[model samples]
Target chain A: MKSTEILNSLQVSLTIKRLCHQLIENHHNFSKSVLIGLQPNGIFLANRLKSNLEISIQDEVQTGSLDITFFRDDFRRKEKPLIPSVTNIDFSIENKKVILVDDVFFTGRTVRSALDAIMTFGRPLSVEFLTLIERRFVQNIPIKADYIGKSIDTIKEEKVSVLWKETNGKDQILLYSPT
Target chain B: MKELSTSHLLGIKDLTKNDIQIIFSTADSFKEVINRPIKKVPTLRDVTIANLFFENSTRTKLSFELAQKRLSADIINFSASSSSLNKGETLVDTANNILSMKVDMLIMRHPHSGAASFLANKTKTVIINAGDGTHEHPTQALLDTFSIREKLGSIKEKKVVLIGDIKHSRVALSNIFALQKLGAEVMVCGPTTLIPKYMSELGVKISHNIEKALKWCDVANMLRIQLERQQIQYFPSLREYTHQFQLNKTLLDKVDKPITILHPGPINRGVEITSEIADSEHSIILNQVENGVAVRMAIIYLLAGSINRV
Candidate 1:
């Protein structure tokens, strides 16, 4: 296999700081908006963003984790059962602006499933997507990120991976292709 | 990334300690989901599950169905009385017909021991044993232990007693395996005939006297007397059984420390336990029922995760 690093730790950190500033420009108070990290992969990114955003605004931001394991369209297609991650949304989402965060944006299916999963809590006044890396091509669903750290163009065979300091002990984005 | 060694939940004996921990932790997450304003999740949206109850069930059937629905799986209910089983259709044929309709998973409660395991070998669909005859009610054991862990904070080193009919209870057998596996001390308390002769071989302590069992236990799981399974007279009369074995507030009050009371219900209120004790603060019977849904969800979610893996 062949791999390429797109962003190192310093670049990733600077991108997150920029994202936090941009978030404050749009959501100054965040009184009506809540941040939801899609489960398993998105949780670390969501936590980092929540921490950064809170420090920048000097105000607490409500955050929770949502696992869409049951809501996926491909669940029946796979032979192995998908182990579910914990969903810890103690607060209601009714009429609130919801920020859905994830490490990478690919086919947009995950975001679509996250949308369906979030409605169960309550109807959101608006929904926004945030991603550390966005693959500009290969979206099966018509979805785009409102807050993107970096957008990269890639072929269908190439995979975009985001490694977080919380999980991988380093912050980096890599693109890989079969040799 | 660790998965259950077995594909189907046939019995408690098939589960290892690690399997139970994974299940309990998964159930813990689901327990949180059910308490939310919107109790439903969408993880099983594309999966279809059929609840096939060859035995009559209120709690097991309803709880399993609720768990399936909350996971967003399409559900179909098949009770033996309402189906072609009454018309003499074989279990295999009935199950095959359901699978023919593209059912992904089967949650079964059957009257014969090992029925779920037997059917599991014959089908490609994942099978979960809700309960099986006088053999093993794996889910009941799971929910019971789950409820116990929720109330007491853990199942390790807890003193638990299974009281009433032990010979004919699938619940007792499964609980013995589960509780013991989780590091709890288990004891069987009942009459000689009702308590099996070979139960001692299963590493369970035996107590014939109800009062002694109650005093020794931190949790007393009062099982319903299976009158239907008794072909011959095990005891002289219901009066005699109640007089000797019935758990009431008076008996419970006499214990030095408060002991938790559990009963797998369709409870014969005045027989195994009085209404006062069943309704008391010491009872976790209803909590057991509530936890049943969460535990079943966890099991289904886990099993479904690996159903069609490449």
Candidate 2:
């Protein structure tokens, strides 16, 4: 199977900037809110959003990265389960609204596991989901994104990989089918 | 699907049969790597690992650092004395700062129990607890098992005697769990105060007489007695304990069967074990130290795989 070229001429940085503006406008009154990025690419996107949010709010917004490897439901199947990256949230999350940011949303298992991992720290007033891309598929749980940059229809065999210059040396989304 | 990658190695008691097998098999692969001339691999190449040592250590810290280096991973050593953590910088802040550098794993040895787990919660790095107060030293136990398996073939139904300061030794606590899981009959012998009464409930027999325990065991593991832990006066005198509990050549004669001697160093020399027994042909004490690197390399390789995939 050949991978489809859905993002052949896409401008990811522009889309991300526009998404940051939308998120800031949506929660302009939040004072102590934080942005928690899920591991790997989500963390990269979250850090980028955090810098942009900090400039717009003119205040220091707490930014953290979370790794959900141990909390995953399918951990038993991975041959070489990578050690999770660092999850760093220095401040308290109790009674404060949080935006759970990620690069892409698929079956929502990662998000579900992220919630389980987050609850171990403290209870939050509410958690809003934000993603750069959302796949058109049935989620295991009734979870929806509060802010989405783009929505793409994909099949089970298809994969959406997000590459950025900060880590991957490029900014593009690839739709690949395993050969 | 590897079960070892998904769970925190906080204690050996929680390990299943499969978990033990995975560690053993992984260590076997690492042993081969140790024998190679190059003695290095790209398994963890480009990954960042941090060593958070809140307590001063020579053996454990160096073994872990060497293990990470041999696996081709970048390592950052954080000594508590020099770290901002000494100036009341919170553990969270230290972790956050290291996280910003994108560390893939954190190997920690703190003076408090559950300190590694606390750091695990704060960071995405896989936490390998080196030693937390007197709580547990999982890697030491794992390497001991590796040493035993190399010598004895199998630990199933083997009589393993653990002699020394049972109450204050983290190595003793971790060995009990590892040995029991591998099907060894573990017995701990020491002064009355040092040997907890309810230890049999943890599947270990407590004996005050080393002579009795020696007669019935295939393997004898001796633990170092920390002078600091004696402030509470657990024993009447160190001299008395040494005379009765120390495993010298004369004590080795009590065992009729072929016996192996093990210890987590630096040995007390004349306290828990004598120079004769420590350097004896039956001693695997040095083997335990050599195996520590291989065992730690296995851990870092398995855990760092997650980060490289990113």
Question: Which candidate number would show the highest TM-score if scored against the true structure?
Answer: 1
After superposition, candidate 2 runs with Cα above 4 Å error: A1-179, B1-5
Task: Give interface RMSD, per candidate.
Answer: 3.0, 14.7
- Candidate 2: the clashing residue pairs are A76-B1, A82-B305, A82-B306, A83-B306, A85-B124, A86-B124, A87-B123, A87-B124
Tens digit per residue, CA lDDT, model 1, A60-174: 8999999886667776466555567889887889999999999889899999999988887888999999998898978999998999999999988998788888778898888
Candidate 1, after superposition: displacement of residue B296 in Å?
1.9
All DockQ scores: 0.45, 0.06
Query: All candidates' lDDT scores?
Result: 0.90, 0.80
> Compared with the true structure, what per-residue lDDT tens digits does model 2 show for residues B104-160?
778889888778778777766678899988888889999998899999998899999
- Give the alpha carbon lDDT tens digit for every residue of A60-171 in model 2: 7788876665456653245555444555666778878889999989999889878866665578888888999899775777789888888998777788988878767777
lDDT by residue for model 1 (B1-310), tens: 4577778999999999889988998898788779877898877777889999988889888999999999889999988888888788999999999999989899999989999999999888899998899999999999999999988999999999999999999999999999999999999999999999889999999999999999999999999999998999999999999999999978877877899889989899999999998999999999999999999999998888776652
Model 1's DockQ score: 0.45
Compare the candidates by DockQ and give the number of the best one: 1
